[model samples]
Target: MTLHQQTTRRQFLQGTAAATAGLLVPFASRSFAFQSPNERPVFATIGLRNQGWGITNKSFKFADFAAFADVDANVLGENLEKAAQRQGKKPDGYKDYRKILDRDDIDAVMIATPDHWHTKIAVEAMLAGKDVYCEKPLTLTIDEGKLIEETVDKTGRVFQVGTMQRTESGQRFLQAVALIKNGRIGKVKKVTCGINGMQASPVIPEVKTPEGLDYDFWLGPAPKVAYRALPEMREGYGGGVPLYSNCHYSFRNWHEYSGGKLTDWGAHHVDIACWAIGASDTGPSRVTPLDYTLPVEYKEGYPVVDDQYNAATQFNIQVDMPNDIEMIITSEGDNGILFEGTEGRFFVNRGKITGKPVEDLESNPLPGGAIEEVYGGPVSENHTANFIDAMNSRKQPISDVWSHNRMLEICHLSNIAMRLGRAVNWDPAKREIVGDSQANTFLSREYRKGFEIDM
Candidate 1:
């Protein structure tokens, strides 16, 4: 099928960039250091819901689960039970992740909190001398990305963003990057990142906070608002969740908690595009929101209706990359990355990487070590394994924070422009949005008292 035609074939699973179960380490390929018998890296998992549970589950084979942290006491208890069943032991539990950070055994943490909490938890975890495996998007704002980068530099902790596509042992994404890097695609020109559109949430009325849930802590960093009943919390694009912890999975739909599809899937595809084009340490020169649709009435980047979701409903954004190449991120078609170079173009997603460059592998394969090289060095069994292995060896993980932040910068910039409905220039070196004061305002958000990430 043509690239455009494939967009409609699969509805695409959101956030999960790759399949987890089929991920197995090549018997000869798990790069682990020789540590003493008791030296397996111990880990804590904060945000014990969906993604949190998944990351922690995947990493347990390589690491020791020492604790569980979450605002919901019920979820925390449930996660502790799962951990006990998985590991034959249950570690400590805490409502405040800060207590987890305080523990002597938490060598690292898998931060799967909502987007608003990703930055603060990551920053403090590094400061506390704990390595971190944080799920994707990395930041709620551009400034948060910088703070995490700085913390990584100063703390020397192994910080890995959960963009597992980079370390796929199958090399689906790696092969695609290798094709572009080997100059097989000719001169790179543009990338079309067809991410899914934003979700619309219904207007929900305020209600009493659910029991066994720490609502105040759950709203950490973001503005304080009433519990908008369970309905307002769940994205209107889909049917409601059984529990009111709608912020756990549905948080991606609202700007206050996340950047909708821009940071959601864009974090995965845009990141691969950056890696392919050799721009992971920098970002686009300009970001322009060519067109957009908002779910509710918008004014000054926020929706007038407080009860409904505010993130963009749909958008076509154009970004000018470093080498005069263009990037088109749209919510119109498929959820995948299409790389177009001078010689040819190709498409890749969770399913398959296809096109001429990929087909060329039949006769003229990638240079012997191209896949390994694209993966930085030797690939890990999985994204979490990379972080745990890196913790012992002190090397950057496959999806290291620096490059993830660079890719995250692109995601944040895309959201900024879409929110403003205009073009904004970005200075990657200085890491600032230029000229427009209002546009620059988006580089950071005001935090709730005592919730700021100390840079």
Candidate 2:
């Protein structure tokens, strides 16, 4: 199976049709050369340490794994070896993702870097005429979310945010949403969102940078900080004290990288909450962060994780949307949604949707066609498969940048409100914070010189 040079559009469309029709469409086959039908949809991956590996591996048969990038040389070497074994050829490796975008041969990129790098790399990739599959929490800031949406429109590049939940049947999640949409809950009144507490990253002394790792590049747009090897000392979540690193996933604590449990997990649940309630197109008009009882001796600063994470360890954020529906997005209890309506109350998470409305789950009472419209319709194909389909279809994947960017902004707003400990008013149509200079400032961060996410 050599590269089918000069294949017609008709052939590509036919192949896509077959694949969509449930046939085994080969994305890449060993019999095919590096130039086969599979290779026609070229793809590269950056940040191939953990999630990147799985995302890249799934693209194995359908795309040519032509290039890989990571700031950590160790991660780069590992990914390169695995990609070579899978593709039957070595791929170009680099530390800077912008260089990967510079390659004319590559048509798409999978970005599995930390939450911070997603926006900058994706904007650049689109500008360079490459489609992008970026990880969730799509932007580090609400402003970056808007910038990404603008860039996607400007570049006309297909982008899929790694919100694979859209692809999942998420039976319980869908069921809960369906229950609300079908009126089983009787004019949904409020959503009580309970997320698990974020653990703190206790202070750890700085350590020498690991060999072959470009620590600076890993920091990327983040301000220059001394390197620390202890897991708690690292930036981003998942670890020690509640504020030093915020909770687990420390970056979620810092304004620069993530929105702690709020955006980290909220992106998923809130997205579901909005979907279930038929409110995805519009978000809450107001976001107020509930105060927390922090331990004494708290110090505040940008990249607050610098000394220790300071993102909300446990707080409730109320987002008031249209229709008197108040979304209580929080980390106040067990992680999930509790829907309290005029008629009944129900809760749902990855595990279950329980309460008086269990009958709705039993009967599937949601509106039949409503789910598709809210979740962007059938474009929500299998995550990896959708990427390949977009490659050949030349169409936006279901979880495209503009759609998810809205969600990202909402998530960011919740964090900003919580961080500032104030109510932040949003003009969703205008996508701006209303008359609050300080709140607006939280919408974007000051990037390290030479590392700003470009327009």
Return the top candidate by lDDT: 1
Reference-based TM-score of each model: 0.89, 0.82
Q: Please give the CA lDDT of all the candidate structures.
A: 0.78, 0.67
* Residue 200 error, candidate 1, Å: 1.9
The digit string of per-residue lDDT tens for model 1 on 165-269 reads 887636577777878898988999999999988657666567777688888899999988877656333344323343332355667777899988889888989
TM-score top scorer: 1
Residue-level lDDT tens digits of model 2 in 228-296:
435434333321212232222344555546667766777777777776776767766888876653212
lDDT of 1 at 31: 41
Distance from true location, Cα of 197 in model 2, Å: 1.8
For model 1, what is the error of residue 184's alpha carbon versus the real structure, in angstroms, after optimal superposition?
1.2
lDDT, residue 322, candidate 1: 86
Off by over 4 Å in 2: 1-40, 169-171, 231-250, 293-305, 355-381
Q: How many collisions between residues are there in candidate 1? A: 2
For candidate 1, give the lDDT of residue 63. 72
